[model samples]
Target chain A: MTEEARRSPERAKRLPRAVREKQILDAAVQVFSRHGYHSASMDEVSEVAGVSKPMIYSYLGAKEDLFIHCIRREANRLLAAVEAGIKPDLAPDMQLWHGLRSFYAFVAEYRESWTVLHRQAMSVGGPFADEVNAMRERAIELVAALVVSAGARRGLAEQAESSGEGMAAALVGAAESLADWWLDHSDVPDGVLASWLMNLVWLGFNDLVEGAVWKPAE
Target chain B: MTEEARRSPERAKRLPRAVREKQILDAAVQVFSRHGYHSASMDEVSEVAGVSKPMIYSYLGAKEDLFIHCIRREANRLLAAVEAGIKPDLAPDMQLWHGLRSFYAFVAEYRESWTVLHRQAMSVGGPFADEVNAMRERAIELVAALVVSAGARRGLAEQAESSGEGMAAALVGAAESLADWWLDHSDVPDGVLASWLMNLVWLGFNDLVEGAVWKPAE
Candidate 1:
């Protein structure tokens, strides 16, 4: 056998199942992001991953299952990155600022992941859309908790509790929509995007908590 | 011939093509909203519209074409409602407030249309998703114009021009997202939902134009 052929088995043996699955998933995400779910192929994923088709199928099942895995993995990674970026010790606005910054940073660094998670998965629809929705619900809950806590600190816990989730849903949607917009307008850096959102959302949220409402000038 | 059958031709003649198409479209929207695109049947649409299947085919084409027509018609109606609600004589904030109130009112009045336009079309993906995106682009442009004008009135045209479209994208997204959230939390009145969004976004936007900014605590 050739030298590379002889080393292949050894490499496979050294890499555990989890490592191989990650390799397959990484390749799958790249391919899916580039071509989307309908047009993406298993062959490209295998070639990019340097794993055989059978091996990928064994690790992650077929293309549908593989796409799901990529979505779930990327969604978790995004949430984790934002969560890690938040400093609970800081004030609510500061915590949100950091979270937004981390979110944009993650999107900027992993454009492919964001593309697959936000664009590809959403357009593919069906169960894929469901997965993205579930992830969004989690993100909303996280923001709602922050809004409620901030309200409690201001002695407006009842008002905050009543409107916090809806407000969080709007904020999450704004962040998501801005990120999707950034996919086309990449010239704007991540920090600026995050800052723009902060100026657009946090200031208003601050006013709401501070009992300053904007009424129509009828 | 039976008395009813004798007058059928006269009735068909009296009802113009446009009216017939509207009847067919209304039924199609209801069916699509209830059963979704794939699971929905033309038979149900015909039954609901009181129009024969062959007549529907002649007027609106097959299931796919009929669905597209439904989406386009509803999108136009929605845009028209919001546009009509805005009074150019009013200030920008009041204009937007009126526009949002009109939007929620439309959603409340035609929950089925909103369901088909927002949830069903999006989940069906492909061309349907493209149609929704096009509608969204038009909305963003409308909001961007409002932002740019508001900025110009404040002598901050340059700042607004640079970020008007992006900010509008975020605002439009927040509105859409909140509407979706309102779908589940229907206890909140249409006025309350619109006011919540105004408090969540308009105040922040107002602050931005007035030269207020939120910065990191650090």
Candidate 2:
């Protein structure tokens, strides 16, 4: 029935489902960042993505589902970035350094994604919050595994292994807080930020693993 | 307005304005922690505090203002606890340890206040975020001053002093993150948690101050 319209140049190049979903997410992020979750609307997202409202609803489901999809996509992207950055062959410290560099770089490049994941997703305080928290826990476990495996190899991993979960959780929080601070202070390089955290946590951690505790002097 | 009502045993011991405000803030912290800022109500806060709705309005203004008041008061209390715990005469490590101990203890004892400050305050963007962030910076500066001045005394503080702001910011974040994690893992002692963070960050910071860098191995 619409053969003529379909043959038109404007409709000649139809996007794949993946490409269309990506476009929708990009626009949804911008809209969500602008208006927040409670105030953001699907119609605005549809208009911004240049897709029909029905297309968005059919592809992404409801607004909450769409928002959760955005969070999941961004979370996976971030985790993938860190995973890709760290070379398995590299030393533990170097692995951490590379991982952190990728992390800060992701935050620098995708401020909207980071904001949605770090702030808006957590603020919602429902199923979305649980999803984000689960993602966070996964990230922490990744770091803890790295720390424990590295220390075990060096024969310096005992104490850290014993309390690796808590330590890893704290490290994730610190990185998150630093990234949030970086939003306002964008002049600093991502490497330096990563290195600062690496130095702050890794060295102290190394020392502890070696049984070199920094005790209070009388 | 009746003399008989005023003379009743239940009304005989009316709190002073300062005491009443403290009671209101405590109640606000609990309610805000439970329901969050948006879901929490003035009527609920008044009822919880055992005060009149008019009293809450007259004393703390609107909902937003009351929330800010609660944040400010709780923030001051936290900082005060840290300040009181750290003696100026103590060594840097000891000073930091003491400060962190008090911080963890405060979080453990006043989980509701900490929840309101850390989660609810930061979740709400705009003015509330700014206020919480400002208070956060103040806390960081306090820690930075402690770190810097102590290093300077031992002739090891110059390097740390240069990037002191960033270092302090990260340290504060790590501590905050630890406290958040501590909420779920309450079995661990506050002193132990504080000590873990102290070992995790302070020792590395000390090494950095001594010009020991954890460089990426080629």
Candidate 3:
């Protein structure tokens, strides 16, 4: 092939928009995951993707825009993982078991995505933190919905919802917190951590379903 | 008496070491809490304390030294608040309750102090994070002790101890995450958040005492 033919503009015309966007986001997540949002540079992202800076700008708009896209993409993946794994037809306990196990597996499979979504994004100073926080709230609400459904099966939904929103918050908070602890204790399988949470909160929540409430000693 | 004569050398003399140290720490907490550790300035801290830069240097060593001192001071204050509120005489549920309540209260009263210890110190990246993380670990272990106490009382101490460490880490993480959530929802009293935690985890924990574990559905 001639040198002129080898240097054709066909290279630029070859890649589809969707494929290029993914390439940019993958590189952006890699860099942002390492140094956090404030410290990550557009220059490094382009170099890592082997694309020019202008290509990144045209495809992803700007740094913050790129970050939100990453967050939205990662959040959808995580939320969907939990959703797909939940077995709605089963008993509440079984459903929660599936959901918790799915969450642990997702974290184990996608450590960088979770880190970028949870730690790195939340620490920054702007709309991205809000975006991350909203996703977190959605996760908590998912737990709350599960708790409410479980409680409703036994006529206990009102209490769990009224008082259970807070319970949902605490339960989800504990799960997220335990997931982080599980990271350092990688010696322990994520399945065990998921089961531990199931035994801790989910079991206790079910007990509350049967007219059981822990009251202070008289 | 002449004003100049009354003032004399006594007025120009340096403050006692103990007093100077406290003043510097108070000022450092204020500055660190306001601007975060990186943006905080020694000059501002000295000025806030009504001392000179030289005195700050002689007393606190360097910026990192001053930050560690601030974290140590504030962490101790928070730990003491938690420890003082806990009673080994109580059941594990109540013991955990009191500890959570005390923690929330400390975060509420010493808002800046806790923020400096939890947020800013962790961000600056060094021994400061380690120092703060150690104090936080102690707080978690303390909660683990309460959980273990119940298991011990039930003659399941061995079982509890084996898993109590992870539970402690999860419990602490839950409390830390909720404490952060409560910061934005200040209208909710500390007792409320503490009680919510008690209902969520402590109540469930009490069930663990009774041999009720939530198992996966068949």
Candidate 4:
């Protein structure tokens, strides 16, 4: 083994308990991604984290609570990544493009985070699904706001905002869904994937606002 | 009870085995949707179908094979529904618009079918994911062809097939993902969901072909 790997105990004791909790949660996401929520057990998570089950329970709550915490933490991390990527000096379309790239980049680097957010969260019943859905709605609303203001600034009216919500839903869904698809298929970079959303949504929304409709042309 | 309930033995004998098999398969899908694939048992399926367990085994294979059968059957039914709804006489854009509407309508009415095709299929490992993804790719390929040809017809000379394929992945993912979102909040009609997609994608794709890009506008 390498020098760092050969001295395992020296590394394990270096971090505070909070840092250790983060370590455990990171391992938990990986396990959850593989087996899903129902099949993933506390025992496996503890084993993967190189910590005892008691130590895990002491830091995070029981299984469901721990999962919720994971979702909350990861969702914020993802959103923050997107938010940080955008620059206010850029135009609305450019801002959206930057955000899309950020999302794809985040998911690409953190595949397990996307998996936990997408696949595992849905299988869960009751409050967990509701929780994830709420977070999703928040994301949609954020995107919808971006679309509305941008459209308005370009002379598109207030009425566009009503339909903007639904449009945002589709745009967000396409981005998240395509991100998952890109995971399985290689050769598509995060920038290109993000660019697809930009060219498709931003450009198209621009066209409709400018009144260049896609008609029968008969 | 209905007259059919009173004439159970008489009706059972008269019904063909092919008809009976279909009834059994439908019942299996319902049961599978409520509980996941692994959690669902043959006994539950038989009980739901009002048939014996042996009959189910005889008609379908073991649990895994039976699930795969359900995926294939449901996938075919869904694809056919979409195909039936598209009219070639309409403009290419309009053809796509109708197809999206039809897709949402199918999901709304045959929610169980969409659920089976989407959620349940992905839950199982290996073969089921591979098969469903292939079927999904075929659907995307059709959309990709539409996008690529539309781009070419406008003298753009851009081969959007590959990128369209990626967008298709995003679009399908969005449709399926939004459908899941819609299930919790049913106030949004199938038509609204479909049109949301039409606006988001159709409008965006239209812009690219026209070369009216959504830039900073400096």
Q: lDDT winner among the candidates?
A: 1
The list of candidate 3 runs beyond 4 A from truth reads A1-5, A8-13, A30-54, A61-69, A87-95, A119-131, A147-162, A209-211, A215-218, B1-14, B27-58, B61-68, B88-91, B119-131, B145-162
Query: lDDT of model 3 at residue A131?
Result: 77
* Clashing residue pairs found in predicted model 4: A204-B204
In model 1, the runs with Cα more than 4 Å from the true position are A1-4, A7-14, B1-14
> Sorted by TM-score, highest first, which candidate order results?
1, 2, 3, 4
Candidate 1, residue B195: the lDDT equals: 94
- Report candidate 2's interface RMSD in Å: 2.2
DockQ in order:
0.85, 0.49, 0.32, 0.35
Displacement of residue A177 (Cα, Å) in model 3 is 1.4
| Residue pairs of candidate 1 with colliding backbone atoms | none
Candidate 3 lDDT tens digits, B92-198: 77777778889999999888997887667655545676787689678777877777888999988997987787787777877877777666667778888786676
lDDT score, candidate 2, position A53: 79
Over the stretch B1-218, how does candidate 4's per-residue lDDT look in tens digits?
A: 56776877534455678877897889989988888777898988988887777777887877888888888888888888888887877766887887787888888988887777776776554577666777877787777777777777787645475676787787776776677667656787888777666666778877667876544444
Name the top TM-score candidate.
1
TM-score against truth, every candidate = 0.96, 0.86, 0.79, 0.77
Residue-pair clashes per candidate: 0, 0, 1, 1
Candidate 1 local lDDT, residue B115: 95
